[model samples]
Target chain A: MSLFIVNILDGLVTGLLLFMLCSGLTLIFSMMGVLNFAHASFYMLGAYFGYQISTYVGFWPGLILAPIIVGFIGAAVERYGLRRVHKFGHVPELIFTFGLALLIEEVVQYFWGKSQMAFEAPGVLKFAAFSIAGNAFPAYKVFMIFIAMGVFLVLLYILTKTRIGMIIQAALSYPETVQNLGHNVPMIFMGVFGVGTAMAAIAGVIAGPVLGTFPGMAVLLGSIVFVTIVIGGLGSLWGALVASLLIGWLQTFAAAYNLRMADLLVAIGLTEPVDVAQSMLSDLWTLTLPQVGPILPYLLMIIVLVIRPNGLLGKRET
Target chain B: MNRFTKSLLGAAFAGAAMVGSFSIAHAEGTIKIAFIDPLSGPFASTGNQGLSHYKFAAEELVNSKGGVLDGQKFEIVAFDNKISAKESLIQLKVAIDQGIRFIAQGNSSGVANAITDAVKKHNRRNPDQQVIFLNYSAVDPALTNDKCNFWHFRFDANADIKMDALTDVMAANEDIKKVYLIGQDYSFGKAVAAAAVKFLKAKRPDVEIVGNELHPIGKVKDFTPYARKIIASGADAMITGNWGSDMVGLGKAVIEAGFDNPIYTYYAASDGITKTFGEAGEGKLKLVMEGQLNPPVSDRAAAYTAKFEKQYPDYDIGQPRIANVIEMLAKAINKAGTATDMAKVAYALEGMEHDSIWGTKVVMRASDHQAIQDVHILAHTAKDVTFDFDNSGYGLRAESTVKMASADSATTCKMKRP
Candidate 1:
């Protein structure tokens, strides 16, 4: 029972962290027709920037300043870079961001070199917040969960209850009509992109110490963030939340248990092969739940895509 | 069409061709060793550091001693394999096409396995274009045991040998009642887990292996859950063979989870990890390596480290075997009386013995071509340390040392000699 409760808490922390990246991503995809392929790179930039800032002035200042710096960079990228390539259509826009992602990784390597940085958590949050069944839970992880939840709440309020949110929602569906109504549609798109990237940066700043601040951090989490939003519904914020939690729980539970496929096969009345190496199903027999934990999210995504087509909350055809 | 103009153009073209041919001939006189490793990926720092050391060793140690085999200078040509086995093979072909006969790589054992097989097949198929592989740091035991090749020579002790020394230290510690084993889910990791189990059972039969887990190599974004599992296992000591960012993440998670027991690792030092661990791992993290750095093994070792640091301030000599590799190669080439005769040089390198910079005698065993040298188990400590690594303000203090002879045993290598 204690293990189950701990797994739930662990899943919540992971799920919320994914939501932080997916929330901004889903918003940008909703607002702008172009999917920002460089979104995760922005997260990497955030971690690097936060690490650099923390070196100069403790972790708190880095937390406040790094995301803001990343926000401006993201805004400039959208305004000057993405805006220039927008007229060339979605393919070119995607290609441009894809190129941007590679460029960002190179720039990061050029500056920081290709190794893990010494980005550690502050002294106050370095200890365990509590222990469950002799297993200590880190204070920083609890802090990450709270911050992610806080961001979700604030984003929810701003997207639904505010005038700018309503304008942004209108612009997503009919940009021409919104522009004709005297709203700055392009400016709204840029703002959404900036804020979305900032959210990713915020995730990076906190996650850097825990996840490891390195050049590959973006690549590690990049595709998974896309999977989270896709399984939720590409443009639906609530859908992203649900999918993120689902994946978080799925992976956590899977990794926490050690179930062998061979045991399941035996239980189902299949005879064990004499020469396992020569058997065609040898790999299947040796497979364990933890070994396939990381791919569970992708498998879930495929199943959801095939059956639902529109995702759990996704409204579009894709 | 003018006779004077045509004659002048022909003269100029003749001069350009002469210069190109001369340069190509000049390059062929030098012993070119292609250093194929990742130079532009997440592991680039390690590869670049190695390249820097190889260049320095070739120039300072080999060439400065009036070159090898009577002025046939050593040259290290860098090739970026991006830490991929397939990419490494492509780079190998490129290196061969460029007339590089000797290849050196030490990053991934997977890449090492690929290059060894490729070199074996290449030598068999194209006898005229044979190449020797000098391995400095890949420590997978199978390279010398089951997959040993005549052309491949390892300058570092393999995993099984390192585990033997590690278990010796573990067996002496009566406080270590329960142990946890965690490693990356790959060949090297599996080897580590297996060796740990084998050696621990033989050495300390009463010790309990509370947990044994293998996490995805570099895909893990969080290690908190894994750390929690380890903590719950009531293990007093943890053993892991994870390196690079994986090591950093696991160490950070272990420290953050407040698991205060000592963690024994193969690569917890060097790179930026020592700096990252800093005070967090003081006395809690221990590493098993080839040489002693904090308390210099000898004055010459200290001076070499100091001079190398002064020359290349950004890098540290993480793999001390680099110097040994170069020195041994030079000795073999000189002994053969020619750099071009790789067959003779290979014969010379077999059963070679030399005094290393680390103040230990290293032997390249004829049976498996695996280097036998003293290995040290060091503990991470911040205070009363003689020297610090990577400017991390922390250093590893020598806890125990394993002799070379005791570390050696008969291998399963059926080497096909020329």
Candidate 2:
């Protein structure tokens, strides 16, 4: 069915966008054992910056400039804010980031106010790239998919195949040894942190037009990013990729299918209730898959946490 | 759960502090009115705009016209309820504690229901300390029907009334063969959907109901999947009761996905939705509401529009009902001969007839406290519109008007007068 294909495309777009955020978050967690709670806020910053710059400069220039500006902000945050709190252990770092998240939201509201911004994709991407079953899949989404893939490949190369990547990973476990080798570990940590946040901003710049650039944009994607990386295995990049795609397809298929729990219960030998609205189990009887689509990722995270606490591809035993 | 509850409590404290600051510099003898609505969160823009309207109307209409009760200034105070029913009750207690005698809130029907119930009980418990609720935008018919309260006076036409007008216009359009209904999964959303189903069936029996869907309120990040479903459903037109961010998201997504059919909406033309819809849905969006904006109904309407644009350039008078609320409230207060006489003021408001800011007659029906007024169905288009929304060069062009007689719905209200 063309509907089926469209769902796949839709799912892929959602999954890849999630990956864009997840990859940065996983990278930062692996490089420095810090769970950046304010990662999504950087994405929100990216959107606002993009909107502002595009209003003056244009989308093409904003795309390149927004992330760079956000990277500098992220670097400053790591240098001035996170580094001071780093000595107090992980909980304090998390507390700092959490506070930072709230602060970013308030600052954004102060500046842009609490309404959806009119940040649109450029005119070039407005036309349909293709159509399936009378649905014109726009060019912007395809651009998003490719940009996400490019980010994945480039990040993989930088982390695995390059000299800076080698030093960054080496410093994670043996910071003293890496630092003694005439390299600054603190600066490296800040760089990784900046890069991670910059990647999040990149996601923001692209997805802002589609998902809407609003004050609540960061909060909307906050919990879901945690779910994706958790299900993927905390420090595993490939696991994050697999998990993001899985969630994408799972949610897409779940939304597409109008399967009812009552049908499932009946199929499993339970009798259906008459006068369903008045039945004690009316909620269960009428519950549909699509209604619970948003919760599937969290449910999956719980299952993974219970079945394999370390995650699907995580190397650590804990 | 502990963290969640702590954050909620923290927010409540902060809200109380904000309300505390607003209570100072009251100006003695000023008739204080509490505007309890969300000053923050997802629906903040809508609520904030409502607050601005109340403030402006109180100043420009009531207070500036030499004040009510002969030079007793009208003051509007802000209370952040966060759009939660429980929070709204919390704010109501705070408002009542501050000696505020009137409450204006209309953003959420669920919150409105909670406020009405609390006000009813509060009046019964302390009749001497009664506060009249001036409902401006909450339009659930149940508020005026089964849950009707004597202290509550709704200036906006209820949902059923709007649907009566919407379906009346929709039924006349032959191109609409299949209808898809989508709304937020909440009381207001459900009310709009139910009203649409009832009216559509009654008016256009031949129209096939293709899809009736409900998505969670303010939770959906992407509406592309929903748009894909609508595209697959082959619906000729989609009806949504979503407001605020939901309206913006749904409108943008459907247009992006090339679902070029018409979208019939309740609150799609203001509160930043108009500009977004203008960018995406130029000719595809239609809205039904009270008051006129594009072609100002009269000279006074035109002057008020110009003044509003000057006062709050960022805000449009999204709820013309808010102006009606202030206008009628001031009239009732003046007629009652005392601002503190809640009973007399409520009585005066009953069956009151007044012209709205848009130069239309609004009648506050005695039985239900629901305003019966002319409802206009406006198309969000760039054609033949002088006053554009959000300065987007696309504004509402009135397509059809439903008079009060045809738009009126018979209520099941059994008035329990005090």
lDDT of 1 by residue, A18-61 (tens): 89989999999987767888999999999988988888789999
Candidate 2 Cα misplacement greater than 4 A, ranges:
B1-25, B69-71, B84-99, B125-129, B405-408
Q: The CA-based lDDT of model 1 is what?
A: 0.88
Candidate 2 residue-wise lDDT, B1-418, digit = tens: 3222444665668778988986677788899999999988868878888899889999999888899987898899899999999999999999999999999998878899999999999999998999999888888888999999899998887888888988988899999999999999888888889989999999999999999878878888888888888988999999999877888888888888889888999888776667766657777898988887867787887788789878887678777778888888899999999999799999999999997778679999998888889888888988887677776788887788888834346788998998
Instruction: Look at candidate 1 and give me any clashing residue pairs.
Output: none
iRMSD, all candidates: 12.4, 6.7
Candidate 1: TM-score?
A: 0.90
Q: Alpha carbon lDDT of residue B90, candidate 2?
A: 92
Q: Model 2 over residues A9-63: C-alpha lDDT tens digits?
A: 9999999999999988998898768889999999999998998888787898889
List model 1 lDDT by residue over B1-418, tens digit each.
3222444565678778878865654356788989999997668889999999999889878888888866888989889999999999999999999888889999989999999999999988887778899999888888998999999999988898888889998899999999999999998898999999999999999999998879899988877667777877789999999998899889888777668899999999878888888888987899988877767888878887888888876678888889999999999988988766678889999999999988789999999999999888989888867667777778788889888934458799999998
B-chain TM-score, candidate 2: 0.91
lDDT score, candidate 2, position A151: 94
Residue B244 displacement in candidate 1 (angstroms): 2.0
